[model samples]
Target: MSDLIPGLPEEVARECLVRVGFDQLPVVRRISRQWKWEVESPYYSRLRKAEGLARPMVALVQAQPTADDAGPAVHKGSSAAAATGGPANFYRMVLLDPAEGRWTALPTLPGPMESIPLFCHVAAADGGGRKRLVVVGGWNPETWAPMNSVYVYDFLTGAWRLGEPMPGPRRSFFACAAVGGTVYVAGGHDEEKNALRSALAYDPEADAWTALPDMAEERDEPRGLCVGDRFLVVGGYPTQAQGRFVGSAEAFDPAASAWGPEREEGLVPDGASPRTCCVVPGTERAYMLHDGHLVARDGAEASAWRTVAQVPEDARAATTVSALPDGRVVVIGSACHGGEQTVYVLREEAGKGGAVWARAPAPPEFSGHVAASLFLEI
Candidate 1:
């Protein structure tokens, strides 16, 4: 290989290859079989991470008005309108690199569907240097029917591949999280709109899903978060609630293969919506956007929700909240329904008494309102 690349030694060539940005991998992979193999290997991915060349990126399932559908116009109402038959819009993944202020689109999912699924969840895992983005189940774009599809996108290969269909009945709006290289899904609604208690875990390397013990109670559209090694499922409506969410919560211990006791209330405050909650990566704490304020809870303590900061007044409801490695939190939302979107970063000043929220440069397209979002360090 060193000889093929001329004067460069194999070690130098490897270093050079590992530094290639993920966006350019597809073009570089076409150069030759040797180059393709080198880029696709797990070792190369690890090399990139080890060399501190990997970038942090945020992936979101966003909505934008469909080009042809001009239907009746409505001001900003709820982000849910995008999927629930609001003005004709399409949902797709959009990638943003805060450090570089760059936005790019991954290839459209490999399917014949005209629009992406509604209510799908996305989770990413670090595969050596190559990162994998896994998109889980949601409703059919055209028929509003439940689906069991699973899609995985590999940064190294720059393409999307289908994963095994979710086991059992198709469920949508479930709680999902990526932990220890595996993705765990629990609680959601079945095709008949019945809340579900079953749960499962997926291993991307093996391309298989194994059954986990069922949750203690049926939950629909629950919020899923990874706290330390445990997967916590909180809030969600019961089949009878018919869209009225409860504050009960439970945690699944993979090692014990069982769900711990359920806190009937407090995990999520009464009247606090679960759709606005997210766990800051690496922080055993979960945050929720409630009444224009950011609230947090320590995973070890039950019902310890505390006010963290007030969200920008313009951000009516936090559609998504993500935390950077440095403990800074990024919130995306609009001031009013159908208002211009904005990105706010909450960071602590070294000598300042408390953290402050400041506006961050964001592309206008992101303002369309985020339906779902996740952060992954490349």
Candidate 2:
């Protein structure tokens, strides 16, 4: 009652508090133990209501080739090699806010597992009362070898918990999607033997692994982008190393039983591995980072390759790309060069000069083996 709770109206205060993030609930709980029940009771109900208004928009997180980031020797080679395995140097994880160009040093992996932080995928999800950014996969740089480790840290908690490892080695491999609370990891170079196309999913709640159907193609550093409900597995290297890039594209429908087909639409060069791709959720069109240019893929008709932007020739090898919520594409990192490069945000422009690229700011020192940014919904 209002009288019993002093100045607060029980029903009104509870609903208002529920709408705020969970991290704020504790402060309110300290008001009184009895008020805690009212605030926490409708948390889920409020979540359901809030989901209605929440739009699935992407935001740029961090970029590669950060100031303190290792070096080029680590991220050099085929995108597959750069992704599916570890660098031959010391492994480290550096957290940076791409928008702010800020940096945070994280504790290294436990024990003597020497490896590089080779493939990184971050996802944004709603966690009870707060938003969470979940970073998955890549190897422990200390081991300097392929690692099956999955570590997740909540910016809210500042605490790290080891998630379930992939079904197979996910080092130097590319492609990760955060659907619901589960993170899907597909394809990567497995130096344990050869390149792999195994698909695995990690459930954050249970901290467990579920083996999904293996991709139709044996791919490494292949691009994984979401189109509608299906996860699109695009171009990457095959088992053989003849610089063969797969032209075929396959779609994985979790609702269905198997992979669809290896089609020409949304396909890359037969031997040119696509390091990254972006899909404007709810649309059929997609974009791929090929060589040093951004290529567009249209699924309905035949997927055609069109260059959108260009980067420095020498920096093509280790560049990472992602799509922003505004439809502008953000590309970062340099492949061959040794110095720190600027993170470019590309907006569509008329004529044939190329998309207008504006350097937002310099990203933190990223580099090393796994140098890419994952979009989180924060």
Tens digits of per-residue lDDT for model 1, 20-59: 8889988998998889888878787777778888787889
lDDT of 2: 0.58
Give lDDT per model, in order: 0.76, 0.58
lDDT (10s digit) by residue, model 2, range 1-378: 333255766655555554654334446656765665554443543553566522233333322332236454333322333554533444444443445555454444443442225456665544444445556665544344555666665533445567666665546666777655556778777666477778876767667888888887787777777666777777777778635776677778878846887575436767676666666555666676766677776554554777776765534654556665556666666545654554666777645555776665533344333355555443
Q: Which residue pairs show collisions in model 1?
A: 45-129, 46-129, 76-337, 76-338, 314-334, 314-335
TM of each candidate vs. truth: 0.86, 0.70
**Distance (Å) between predicted and true CA of 323, model 1?**
1.6
In candidate 1, residue 312 scores what lDDT? Answer: 78
